[model samples]
Target: MGTRLLFLVTAALANGVALAQTDVPAQLRVEETRASQLMPILHHLTDIYGPRLTGSPQLRQAQEWAAQQMRSWGLKNVELQPWEFGRPGWHNRLTEISVTAPFQAPVLARALPWTPSTNGLIVADAVILMPPGMPAAGRAPRRTADSIQAAKGGVAEPPMPKMNASPPLPTRAELLAYLESQKEKVRGAIVLVGPPAAPEPDFIPQPMRRTDAEWMALINAPPGIAPGSSTRPTVEDGRLTRDEINATIAEFLVKNGALARVKDGGERRGLIRVESTNGYGATPQVPGVTIANSDYGRIARVLQGGTRVEVRMNVQNELHPDGSTAYNVVADLPGTDKSDEIVMIGAHIDGWATASGAADDAVGAAVMMEAMRLLKTSGLKPRRTIRIALWGGEEQGVYGSQAYVARHFGSFEHPKPGFAKLSGYINLDHGTGRPRAATYFGPQSGAAIVAQKMASFRDWGFMGANTASFRPVSDSAAFYLAGLPSIGLYQDPFDYLSRLHHTNFDTYEEVYEPDVRIAAVEVAALAFALANDDKMLPRFDANDIPSRDPAAGPRARIRPPENHGEP
Candidate 1:
């Protein structure tokens, strides 16, 4: 009887090992297939649906399509959760700009979203307003009848006159002075404003996946040293306060009867960087447009040479009422044992209207959807429920995620019953880069737990995990502020900052198939591990708050100097 029992025990152990070996490769293959097959999903979200500005009809369509897709994939509890977004809805139907005087040429430009539209086609003389401290170029010499007669006599014409160098933009006081002195010149003309003061370089190095040693140090470091200790210098003081200076400029231009305000495009290679209209909650004082730098430079040269420059522009935009409700798409895959516990993953679904927001978030959304599909279809029934939330108003201020947390899990100031059941929240909104590591924003006690949970996937190129104070930039900010275990996936830069982020070039082609596929596999594996973990992830003590306001809601109270909520 003892020999028979030993044989059965050994056979059971062998079968368990075999199952474990088979599970990894099988799940990996499923994710691989998902990665390669993501093009159709990408096309549908970006190409077919087009730009999904929050609260717009297109975004509503996208939310419906995403919810339907989730349901079709067998995800349960699929619904479009509504939230109050305190902003007016806006859409741009038509925009056109061209140079009509001194030379006829097309000028590439895009109207700022949500700004007031030109009543109709406006043809006005262009005026280049140079800043203070720089001298304006002298007028070019004109050819007289005597000069033409002399040139006809075969004598060399007078040497061409030299043009003075372009001037730097004016300071606040100088700008005020220019506006006062040239008020009439700027009035009734399309004024081209110079770029603002150059900002200081961002010296902070981009974060990569944490190494094992780094993770160990994070677990051992004292409070205020590891997280929330960044002493990065800010350029906020150097910036012209938008409401004070920029708004004054806009008001002054409008009061002076300016037809439209055109600014030089900051982007290189003809890329038009578009943004929302100025002055939230109110229509802009004047219509605004961003002209390509090359064309703008040409106009500036002509104006400096004392030549009249004219431009023709037409912009058609509409603003809906402010009370329109935005929605977040939510779906779930039920768990088995600890069904009440939850592991959540999300990406923002809304994007700017200038381009298909493929790289900014569509890639992350696709990965989340595909990961859920792989786990569900692969027959992996986790011990805890897995929830997927495609957020709205993230681009605005992470309103969708904040509203979700406040409604379901309660805000930091007010804890609810659902808060305790949450195991962890994972977010991937950076872009379509490959996932290399993760940053954990929970209590120090949870570091070891995360490390152990992530160890199995080290072979898949996970750099391990490190504890860091969360920056309230992405949707993870809301979860972190509430002291829940939250994480942001670290990824390769992949031109997300330099080129594609929020630009017209952010289209479907920016997706790198192999890298995105790897990211999908990593995200799916992480979600599965978190869901199946035995214990709930630890949270920071209520008093141990990060360097941010817990009650600030979606708009992160602490914004970086470079991004002062311009959009």
Candidate 2:
């Protein structure tokens, strides 16, 4: 009878301990995260600092500010870790593009980064420059029988004009020769490349979240469903690539004394999608701009009506000297017994210079900062140290994170002293949407561990865990390729892809406060849990670490220093 009573008592004590362990996350959810505490951090990153393009002065200033804030919060070992950028840093000072002829109107446009300034305002006539064999736009064509049958059968139609078949694009040599032939016409004109398509109307409402059915389908689907690496095609692509073609056209413009090159921005509803110049050097000789599709279409229509259109443009840009480098912001929250082991949370601090880059990465950097603050203020003593890295050069080629990993913790082919001591990394770079669940890239058992650890925050929309479809192409991919355990959060789409990404609309107003607050709290809880766990997150064997493309991975192409100026 005494033995039975003692057994019951022991079981109750064990159960009590388990309950306390689970309650820590619950306690954090209820007490630590507050909107007032979080929004100010985000405001400083976006509103005050604006876009932090890698190697730009704005990014350098922001990195210093972030490091100072981490130290003031009682975090230790804060530093601005530097890495070679290998090219001149460029930023836009002023860009003014307007349509003055046929009728006075303002055209929505922005200069491509790393492109040259026009030196001053220049007014010039416009000429249409289409690629060889690309058919000119005309009246709508009648639908073919195949199209009608495909529509009736609910099959997707082919992605081309209905009945207006066009010849194949010219070979590379042929394209160059054709451009040489048009030298006289392009010598002194602002070239408009290609006709613009009318924007299609979107009828469906914005999705709040993917349904369970949709997620399951995505999980079960074969690999390559989602996008892979976005590395541009090179000489090895076996044929003429669009990038090569564009580069050739730009070279032609430079040689032929063209005033500038303008194209449709390829976005809907007057939104302009911005991108950098393809050149690896400081800037190109001829300037380039992508205006709103609506504006481009209007100009094309006027030109088709034989009414000559003229444009006036004035652009200014600055480029840092050769051998300039960018930096990553690093800090640490020391632990109790397991201070040597590290758990990392990171987000990129750099973004495209289109807007303030609020959704692209400002929200992400804010989340990491707030997570550190939450853990510190809650007086939690984790077992492993929690580190935060605000990475730079992620927009260029994820250079900051890769450089840190290679320097501190070497890759699978080469291991450093700290390689084995690191536990795992959690990265948030998706957008301002709430983090719905955690996805890991490792053994199958790690999913169960993550699901168990995240049970406490189920109501905050973090309920489940799943294996990643493929390795991430963001900052996390660096760690993943290095054979370290890495985790990523799956969030709602929330205009990140359709409207905001790399566009002028990525301002502070696009951020939803409540959602990002939840994201910060979830990151804090997960980091703390991983820190105190008995064992680290499961990792794949060295042999199982998948190899990635050389072009798509960390190492970026370095241009010669001599090419850092106008020819």
Candidate 3:
């Protein structure tokens, strides 16, 4: 508040903005804005905090730690706003699985987050069930030739509805409609059985786009399951209309008589890591768990042959039912000139409890913390307020961000005021691959122009990286839905697709220090620039996509930003 202190603070903030732009003094560069000072904070977050599983104790600790750290660094209004929603909270505390049966192998996997848990002892031989391919009685065994031929676009038989089953599963349309409703019939106990495969093995299926109808057409028409061992079956999740397939699967389940068909493992088979923030569009399994993929495949093979395999898994995950409420962490560092106007950066602090959720976002939470620290400590006073959110329940269809946006901006019940004043929301939830680039995701014409402006201070060439855009998947989507300008920061990944993304392997060692430092700096600098920029980012073209009319229920929204694919 003194003249000297004010001058010093002004000078330091000016320097932060300048150093990011032009070549600066060695002393300041080496001392004030270097990456090394940021490491300890990152270490504390990723290492000490470990994995901040959503709604778990760790997530709460990290949230409090972040708020305290930010406030200590001189941020005001650093309060954790409790988010109230239908399903504000869900978690899996302890999951112990022992394969007790013929040829028993200790299961090496965790159930997905928000999945029900088991407490009873139930055992059965592991079943390897394949996808709904042709009835093995009429089909050949799986082979490389079969895989290869199935990869091509030639079906042998017309599709036929799955028969000889219990009852019909939820229809595709039914599933889509259900997805909108944020509700589920969480029963007594549910065991997470996924595809049984080598742990986190790296593999990619041939890229093939097939919708539910297309897949059914492939199945019933000619030779649906790979003919002999010549062709391969492929599914490109990105390009396919998964909702349709999910509905079909649901319908099949309902039509078929089964309690729940769980998979055994991850990746190779249909089993995916429950902790992973990523998800297949529609809920793959409702009444059942996505059991071990390997187990399912094995069971399918036996069934295909002349062997009948009956396996049962006793599952028990009891919830308090009375005690379940999730919360989101919302803290702020007000600006001097434009304190009410906002510049928000968010990352889901909560995680799946596989292996301390190190990569999925432990790195992200740390980076956001570091970015806030940089802004707070550096004595930077921009024109807009800087807000950070450590969202809870994001893994369960982005409930945290959705709740906050609805509460502050607008929601299903009523639209809130102050929409026009919100400058932008910046979110960083991708793992610790380093902030490679910022996606420019708004409208095409306007997005191009805004992207150029951000390129000015993002010394990492992030503007060209294409992460600053309107991808309706992460927390950013929540803000975008309100018609405010926003962006999501992205970093490079180490085994993101195969190992880390959301499995136990997402530990501390996997995060690249240099990459995180670079990311932290990029995000901080961009926050500064966006806060200081004279204009707001552009909006998506009205004609680009149809708006959500609330005709169906609210479901998880995800989008692969334009022009990003495997290298």
Best by TM-score: 2
Best by the lDDT measure: 2
Scored by CA lDDT, what does every candidate get?
Answer: 0.71, 0.75, 0.52
User: Model 1 misses residue 555 by how many Å?
Assistant: 18
Task: List, residue by residue over 278-365, the lDDT tens digit for candidate 3.
Answer: 2221233333344445654555455456553434354443333322456776777787677777878888777665566766776777
Superposing all C-alpha atoms, what RMSD in Å does each candidate have to the true structure?
11.0, 7.7, 11.7
Q: Candidate 1 lDDT, tens digit per residue, 188-235?
A: 888887632222222332343335565455445543323322223333
Q: Could you give me the TM-score of model 2 versus the true structure? A: 0.85
Q: Which pairs clash (backbone N, Cα, C closer than 3 Å) in model 2?
A: none
Which runs in model 2 stand beyond 4 Å of their true positions? 1-21, 31-35, 133-169, 216-238, 280-283, 547-567
lDDT of 2 by residue, 1-567 (tens): 145643554464446533255556644554443223677887888888877777788888888889998888899999998899888777788888888998889888877777787858989998877677533322122255654564556657667777565555557877878787889988779888766765444445347576656655544444331443343333333346555667878888989899888878755777876755676454355877878878888898898788999998888877876426889999999988999999999999988888889988889999899889877866678899999999997777678898999999996668898888888899998888887776677766776787787776666666577665554667877787687778888777687766777788999999998898888888888999999998988887755555544453432212111101000
Q: Where does candidate 2 have its weakest 10-residue lDDT segment?
A: 558-567
- The Cα error of candidate 2 at residue 286, in Å, is 1.4
| TM-score, structure 3 vs. true | 0.64
